[model samples]
Target chain A: MADPLVIRGVSIDDTFAEAFPMRGARIILTAVNARWARIAAHTMTGFATSVIGCKCEAAIERELGPEDTPDGRPGVSVLFFTPDSASLQQRLIERVGQTILTCPTTACFDGLPDAPERMPVGKALRVFGDGYQSSKVFGGTRYWRIPVMEGEFLIQEDMGKVKGIGGGNFLILAETAEVALAAAEAAVEAMAGMPGVILPFPGGIVRSGSKVGAKRYKTMIASTNDAYAPTLRPITTSDLPDGVNSVQEIVLDGLDAPSISAAMRAGIDAACRLGVIRITAGNYGGKLGPHHFYLRQIMGQPTA
Target chain B: MTDRITITFDTLPSGGEGLELDGITPDRLLTLSNAEIAKLPVWMGRRSVPLGDIAAIQGELSAHLRFEGDLARAEGVGAGMASGVLDVTGSVGDGAGVAMRGGSLRIGGSAGMRLGAALPGASRGMLGGEIVVTGSVGAEAGAYARRGLIVVRGDVGDSAARGLIAGTLVVFGRVGADAGTGNKRGSIVVLGSTAVPPTYRFACVYRPTVLRVLFGYLRRAYSIPVADRFVAGRWKRYCGDISELGKGELLTWAEA
Candidate 1:
């Protein structure tokens, strides 16, 4: 099958990464300046690494220009995903309340203004103003102005929710930890600022790739991916090559299938550099997720 | 197939009874032929007259309906219209847009009393839609309005927004006395000078972000002349009608 088409000495696996459906919402946080906007965004996305423990997965989608925001201020776009819309609304209210509302000179708006499904995130938080809260409808959209310790906090009345795909991932296998880290960084840099896709891990790199369930612990929903562990080569069913010493994963969540596919192309292309041994994907057969992004097909190579 | 239907006054009706032309809205005429539109009845001085007898009908109805000539004796020009655009290039009588539910009504000239105001026996006025008057308007412009927007480019008479429930009224010119006496929940923005009622308590002066959005929309959608100073200026807020719900507000331009 075309000799398994190698690019820059790195083998591309034919397998695909399985991504499941997730409920997602995009929030736009604007501030007096970029620094404060970033501060609020980072704080709101904090403790939201994965739905396994955090009940949600969130990350900064991208930095938005003034023209891209509703209030014409420096802004940041963030995406939050949960198992359902109910949990998504709960997490959004709690995080937006604890972060953007408390941050100085920060205002929040709905990034997905055209989505049909809406959740009242700001309406739930307006009670913080007690009897002093006021609402204004501009351009047919309602916004609540709450009197905060600062001047005022303006938040859109409703945040939109849509069905998205999550857990699209690929494993970067390299000969050393440093090589794996460099490749992961290059992959993240390539995929950064891509519209509708987010890498939720720290610096867009996941050191602890996980499997579906624990080996012995029945209560644990997930445990470490032992097959790819170099240290467990002798004890476990190792999936690593002979010279591979380290592996790092890049997990992606996106609004749709095409966005994840485009991001995977960019990441895989940038990661096929020197010291990277091979590129593979994580999947639990083909039953869990409806979307399957095959590496070889995405790279424009025929699959066997 | 013309996109607009023009109705020009062939013989201006002269009387104090005032003509009730409520059914001549753009939405109602959109699907009717010119012959059918002429057959629609309009009340004139206690007598029902065909629309073709008073006005010269031309063009087929579509999204826009244009009225030409002076209509100072014509009442309810766009009353109860729910959708489409109604453009009047002449002065209109009282209740120009009374009890309107949706759509936009643009008057190129002056209007009589109770523009966009609630009809008699009705608790609420316009539920939605927008009205723009380029000339002066008479008293009680948006009285008891539930939800809508009214922009007046000229002066307004006394009691402009009496008993307003919830909506926005922006007056670019001078306003007479008792502008918002018993408003329960609404906003009256006076770009020009206005006499503030004693019942309203002065609130803080700040630049609301929503104003910028509204100004931007007005400039883009209706081609209204929005001064740069108003777009960037701060407004002095006054909360009032304490005798009622005490939720209404009057925002006046502090400078520029």
Candidate 2:
């Protein structure tokens, strides 16, 4: 009906999406202009590709308006998430203290105001000045002024922490690495800067998306998801159809269900193009994680 | 109830014990259960009593605490409070925030002399913290304050900051003469006008940048009402205590 919607003649699969709960915070980075803003944001989010080994997962949430920021300048909002408030607080302090505070024209604020658990991220970090630091309270929130070489650096006293969703994703099976990469890039480009969504993967593509556990390594918690691997088609119960020679996956983390759903919808629709095969999701038979997003349901159809 | 043990006197003490708060930091007491706070120690007239001996404890040891009843004879209400909100529902005796490091102490009524001032033999008063008195203060509201803030919403007596080391004091009502007689570094922001001492020399007529920082602190921390002029108007800066460090300043409001 729509050019048969085939990438290398591999049928375009239909399914919904899924996600899980996690804690999240937003870090805003600013500089003299967009260039510095991007630089700080990039460095802050660097090496934090996934929560699997990083202990915390993060990505750029969006670009903020000058009027929307504290210093009235261009800024980027980065969402970071962990399993708990304590670790979340620690991670925020470590990251912001190293990245945003050291960067010029930058200040940090609690992105989630509605969170019940208020953390003293700034209050604890104020001790860096030994005894010279001074504090000013504005609107009942205290801000610490630590003298730096350039001038005084002001940071909000507390940051808000809230629960969010993690591990929302979909897979794109293509006929070749070029098609897979191009499609993954397009899907990433489609979802880039989408509100409340973050693609926390290298170049927004993951070739090593894993299944729950390993068949060979007894101690391994996860191993390669070999179902969609083209090379394993002849040796294993391959999920890839004929002519679907390669695949790449896009993983998303977001503030909530609707955000993941929105990003998934945008990404899947964009991937349904030339040289694209079927689209599917990764899950453990619906036994784990509370959230479930069926591909067909996300494609505006009833789940089978 | 609050984790902090507050004692309200059933009977006022005749002799001044001069309560000391060197050991009490709000952080240590704020989150304890009631059973936990009953064990802390405080001095009675000449003897020591458990904190549970006087005031009835209520609420949890939250970041905020409110103590009611007359404390006119009670000294050291918020002495040594490091961090947390301490609200005295009535008048307090003296030596509040003596050598205080940080936190806030708000008194609903008058405060005795040496409130937020240094204890005897000590070089400085409150090292850091904010003491706000809603009613009149006896004398030396912020004397020898090294670094902190003291605000008197009411009238203050004479020799407010005698030998003040460095800090800030904002008096909304009348400030008695010889307010900043000290010869050191500090600032006195007087919203109410009074005769300046001859020892002080007029420095400049400019709005102080510190006012922006101080006003913001007042509005946010204590919920104090701030007038537009105070935040936007010019100030008359008098630099003196020249006999000492000569670093002190008295920033009076300049009339339009």
Candidate 3:
């Protein structure tokens, strides 16, 4: 790595985060209060970490005020990411039907109302009302009102589909696990609340970073990145330089490449605290995905 | 080039039989010049006269429009209109926005009978659009509407929203008797009392989620004076006319 550039005494590697295109959607979940809205959002986004097993990736984007919502209520914006448009739509319908509809005084709306492509998520869920559901159109958008036990659950007839970029990641190399954890936490705190980007991993940090395809298990699609594993430093052609004993990855999924790059810049800047050996990113030699988020360029450092 | 269209007749003789201007719409007027619009044919009693004989037209029709005249005898002022803004500076006659598909029609003064009602034998009226009347309206306003909204700031005549299929009619003032008489499915919302048809039954007195949304929209979009009480207040929903399909509703703003 040609003499990495340093940001605040920390070396920034000349690497890039590879991101693949994923279909996603933004949905608004509103309720009588913010608490219930949050509960519905959290319940809906639970277990939706990775597309490999969970079939989708989702997280809460932000909390919206009453004036920001269509129904003038407290709302939470949630984003769902999947490999394709069809799966993304199906996952949204399934999750919204089960969680948001079941929640008390909760209503769902389309966050990406201007997007051209639409998925009939609320339309599909309207059948649960058993023919008693009614729809109303305002400002050219249709909203379905389904009568539930608690009250009426209102949802938009369709949610917009957006072409998004997922799997944008950067690996933070540190001298110890404590430094790594501290740096990851700092990064997460910095990247929180940034629009158009979401840190899908737990607490915005991933301990078990995976590499494409396994070494021994041929059937497995992904395996641990042994190169960055401190335990396998001696056994593998370890990418961890000397004194780098621990590594943590920050995985981001965003609506666009620029969003991911912007978040990564903020995150990497925060992670450049003391004891941080270096900041690098994960990529498959520029072959895996279409979007390449260069570390140094994102940090606004001059190129060599 | 003028950015808007304005047709002014100042004062036409009242109680004329059927002075029709149904062909004159914002979208249609935009494609014609002042002279061309002036030459457009309009029925005046038994004789068809060019529009210039009565009204003085000015400006090219663009995004917004203005109609200044006493046209209480006029018929179908903006019928089948699909787009653009047509603001009637004075009172209009029957079928002001008959069978309109889209766009907005705002009337500054009281309107005559059949305001936004279907044609003589048509099944539906005012398919998709918005109508805001600042003054009172005569009988059968928003009758047989398929889908759209009508917000009348003043009192309404009898049979408002009668047989409404599916849409919303919000009357901020008093409504005459037999509102939503045989409505199959739709909403007739009144702020004050209305002569309830016996065929209708009281359902519940609760706040509807859609009303809050629609009221907010009306307050913001059209600057309609939708009070906070109406937005936050309870409404007495009376489902009627059970004598028909029994899906329509008349929601009176509960004073208590």
Off by over 4 Å in 2: A1-14, B1-256
DockQ of each: 0.36, 0.06, 0.56
Predictions: Cα RMSD each: 2.6, 9.3, 2.1
Look at candidate 2 and tell me the lDDT of residue A151: 48
Prediction 3 global C-alpha lDDT: 0.86
Q: Compared with the true structure, what per-residue lDDT tens digits does model 3 show for residues B49-111?
A: 898888888897475778887777787888888888889988888888988888898988888
Instruction: Give the candidate number with the greatest DockQ.
Output: 3
Candidate 3: residue A132 Cα off by (Å): 1.4
How many residue pairs clash in model 3? Answer: 0
lDDT of 3 at B159: 88
> Between 1 and 3, whose TM-score is larger?
3
The window of 10 residues in a row where model 1 chain A has the poorest summed lDDT is A131-140
TM-score of each: 0.92, 0.59, 0.95
Model 2 lDDT at residue A74:
73
Per-residue CA lDDT of model 2 for A1-304, tens digit only, reads 2233333344545544456788888766555577778878887887777767887888888888755665445778899888666788888889888987788756666677667778888888888766656565433456676656544466778887778888889998877889888888988999998888899888777888888778999888778888887888889888887788888999988888888888888888888777886778887777788888776666665544
Task: Name the regions of candidate 1 deviating beyond 4 angstroms.
Answer: B1-18, B30-35, B56-64, B89-91
Candidate 2: docking tier: incorrect
Residue B185 of model 2 has an lDDT of 69
lDDT-better candidate, 1 vs 3: 1
